[model samples]
Target chain A: MTQVHYDKIALIGIGLIGSSLARMIRKAGLAGSITIASRSGHTLAAAKALDLGDHYTTDNAEAVRDADLVIVSVPVGASGQVAEDIAAALKPGSTVTDVGSTKASVIRQMQPHMPSHVQFIPGHPIAGTEQSGPEAGFAELFAGRWCILTPLPDADPDAVARLTRFWEACGSRVDQMDPEHHDMVLAIVSHLPHIIAYNIVGTADDLEMVTESEVIKYSASGFRDFTRLAASDPTMWRDVCLHNKDAILEMLARFSEDLASLQRMIRWGDGDKLFELFTRTRHVRRSIIEAGQDVAVPNFGRNVQAPTDSAKPD
Target chain B: MTQVHYDKIALIGIGLIGSSLARMIRKAGLAGSITIASRSGHTLAAAKALDLGDHYTTDNAEAVRDADLVIVSVPVGASGQVAEDIAAALKPGSTVTDVGSTKASVIRQMQPHMPSHVQFIPGHPIAGTEQSGPEAGFAELFAGRWCILTPLPDADPDAVARLTRFWEACGSRVDQMDPEHHDMVLAIVSHLPHIIAYNIVGTADDLEMVTESEVIKYSASGFRDFTRLAASDPTMWRDVCLHNKDAILEMLARFSEDLASLQRMIRWGDGDKLFELFTRTRHVRRSIIEAGQDVAVPNFGRNVQAPTDSAKPD
Candidate 1:
């Protein structure tokens, strides 16, 4: 069992990431108790039904009172309100962090309300599935994944180290980055991909000539991969798009510029150029596999039997 | 076991689709004998090593000499050449089919060289993984997937029925579509998704702000899904882009237009627009799952334990 890092941990927004944290903390014995909070009475009752926390309340302030660690796991757009709701109730010397995708905006939203005696560190665990809600989370969600923390300067070093240890105990490897840099990196690697997926799925849905049934029937050809991301929580993603506007716009602009060039290459039947780009992008997947970011098996090992022979020809 | 549908089945190209057909035919006892052929001696040797056929040859013509069915699975750009190479040696009353992605282009490329005595039917199995080459195929690759055939006006009815039975025996549901319609549908469902995936991966690779390692490290956030399609056989995708130029261009234009509007929504903080699009697309994925085109489990059931409860919230 992991060492108890907090006497009472308060979890805000008991959705996928939040409930997953509660599960991990309980499974690892990292907290004496977990106080689950959500603005929605339905969500709070659901968390209670799931037995995900030792205590539950609809009032954020009531949940955070006397809690040593407060974790906010709401949509980025709601981070500031959640912070303001819980700020006056947070225990002195507690550490407050979040699991939002965008770091800079989350920091901007939550930092102003944090008490001077408490440590407010903005964090993003680079983990999740398209599924969300209290019932959709598991203790293993954070295993083998990277959790990035963007702690502000002048934050207590002990508090930062303690929160880092908390994430480590939850099966995440932790890293610190400037919040702005974290936002930019995540904009390219996460936000842009999700937005692109949503856009493409939307495009397919809007096509008149290509019937929706045909698209679904033939989706295994390639389109189904994008659907997983497109099916993610709409509120979470919408907030992300609104919160990280500049970085997302910059990435989207770059993506559209590159796509325009690619479209031109297709228009001109520039086989060499298309081949070059396709080939170069291949090495990135390989690198990702080698880094243990993804399974190397084919089709993400989905439903197909493993091949008996080598994958390479020569 | 499936009834023997052909005296001998000759497979040309010996790549992912070709080798998969070889394995399925062998497992289901659909052919009296099998002949594997490829232009590359290395691929031929790999097929032989897998014992994928009764006979193997590097000469496409030699393999098809006495075969009742000749299945060409080469890249679309090479379809014309393979047809020309094997046209004279094809047995009389035999059926010639292909597994090229773009049916119209494959028909245009191979039709002129076809012999009137033999039936030529262009087909595409909407099944594959990112892995390629002879060794990457398995018998289950086409199970429960769709196989589309676009036959010419003068094609023999008996030959078309036989080919349909052949695909069904190999565990695929068969659909007949006009070659032009097939190309258009595939452009939106298959080709455009792949092109967009490759384009996004390329954009990420070209980024100076986000290091490659960072992208790889945090890929599971969303970028990894695109990498799977982007890592697909480069040669085949390059040929697909070159051959299905017009339909692909049209789809790309539609996609780019939608993306531009979505970008404006983000820039203007139009959460309602974003939320509407995002919510509408979620139903498509649910429809896809309900249609049995994709798995209902989260993350494509990739390495995660099953959730214990319902996915929906009250």
Candidate 2:
């Protein structure tokens, strides 16, 4: 047993990231009980059937009643609503956090609704797959990922430390940052990437020049990467785009302007400019791999002895 | 052991695809003698040191003198030069092909230089990772990929069939299309994706609103996918862009128009339109996965392993 860090932890979203957290917490023995809640009855039933939590309910408030830690893992647009709903029900001194992609917007939406009785630390686990829902989760998902926490000035240090320990037990390396910096960083990294993915995929779909079948067939070329990004959760991404509008637009402007310059290079047949940009970008992939973000396939399945799930090379 | 399909095979330009083919042919025992040839002395020496072939030389003409099959796997722009160099030395009636991305361009560049007695068939295997060089390959890289042949109307069928069988033996499914159609199809699927990836990564790098560090650290969200494509072989991709200009610009116009429409949707908070477009896109990913083009990963291995090379996580 990994050992329980909390007697009761309530998960408020029960979607992909939320469900993954629930599974990991269960597998890691980080919680004595997990109370699952979502706005959808169908999702609640599915989580109940999956045995994703020790307790399941469609009532967000009811889920957090006696919970020691409440994690709100919903779309950014719904964070405020969830915070309001569970504000009165949260136990005194309970640690409250979230796993939303955008931190500044999340804190702005959630912190005001939260009662001072609870510690509201905004967080994001920079990890996930295109798949969503409670059934689409596994315990090993967070084994080596980073989880950033953005806690308010008034937040209790002891509560933050405890939550840090809790995430550590769940296989996350925790880092604390100010909410504004977190928002700006993610605006460039996570939020901008999704917007561009959606944009490019939409671009291809609307094209009359290329058939959809052709796009999918030869996708191994490069277009397929955008499809994975494009396949992300519609509701969740819609909310993120709406919530992080300024930062996203700023990043988008930068992206578009940069693209214009590169396009000029192609138009002018500037191979040297193209070569320089291409060569510089290669170092980033190297850094990502060195930082343990990538595991080349030749080394895959080496230590993995028949994983219990369907994520192999079959 | 796989049956030896040819007595001798000469490979010109042992980069990513060329080196990969050499390895695959060796592993499958399809070539009695594998001759590796490239203009770069460093690479030829490296290929020889890696034992990638039975014969290694820097001269393309010298390498093809006695080979039954000649595979020119250089950047598309270099195809004409290689063809011109090897035209006299090729054994007449021997089959010759290329692994360039642009088909019409390759045919135009290589056809006049070839001996009519030699069956010159143009082929492109729609398979590769972002990495290049002889060491950056594996025998299974072509497994389950599509190998496209764009043969001239007067090209011999026997040669086409032989090349198709060779690709199949190397674990690929073969398809034939007109050179013009191949160029058009690939413009959307492969060329545009790489261009956009290069463009967007350039965008992120030059963004005044977000630091380069921010772009690098938060890449897991969606931007990293673009990075892999941006990090692709510049010379190969630059040639692809330059050679396939008309098709790429057509696709680009469609993409830009579609992106404008989607941008308007986001600007007006048209959730219904946004939701509809986003929802329709998800099926594309499913279709690709069903077609065995993409695989899902728990995370992008910083926290998870990338199940595939080009595509990034949510």
lDDT of 2 by residue, A180-246 (tens): 7887778777776777677777777766756887777788777777887788899998887777767
Docking class of 1: acceptable
Q: What class would a CAPRI assessor give candidate 2's docking?
A: acceptable
lDDT of 1: 0.89
Best by DockQ: 1
User: Taking the candidates in order, what DockQ does each have?
Assistant: 0.47, 0.41
Q: What is the TM-score of chain A alone in each candidate?
A: 0.95, 0.92
Residues A1-314, candidate 1, lDDT per residue (tens digit)? 33336899999999999999998888778888999999899999999999999999889999999999999999999999999999899899888999999888888888889989899988999999999999999887887789999999998888888888888778778889999899999999899999999999999999999899999999999999899999999999999999999999999999999999999999998999999999999999999999877888898877465332322111
* Each prediction's whole-model lDDT (CA): 0.89, 0.79
Question: How good is model 1 by TM-score?
Answer: 0.96
List, residue by residue over B28-130, the lDDT tens digit for candidate 2.
Answer: 7788899999999999998988899999888899999989999999999999999999999999879899999999999999999999789999999988888
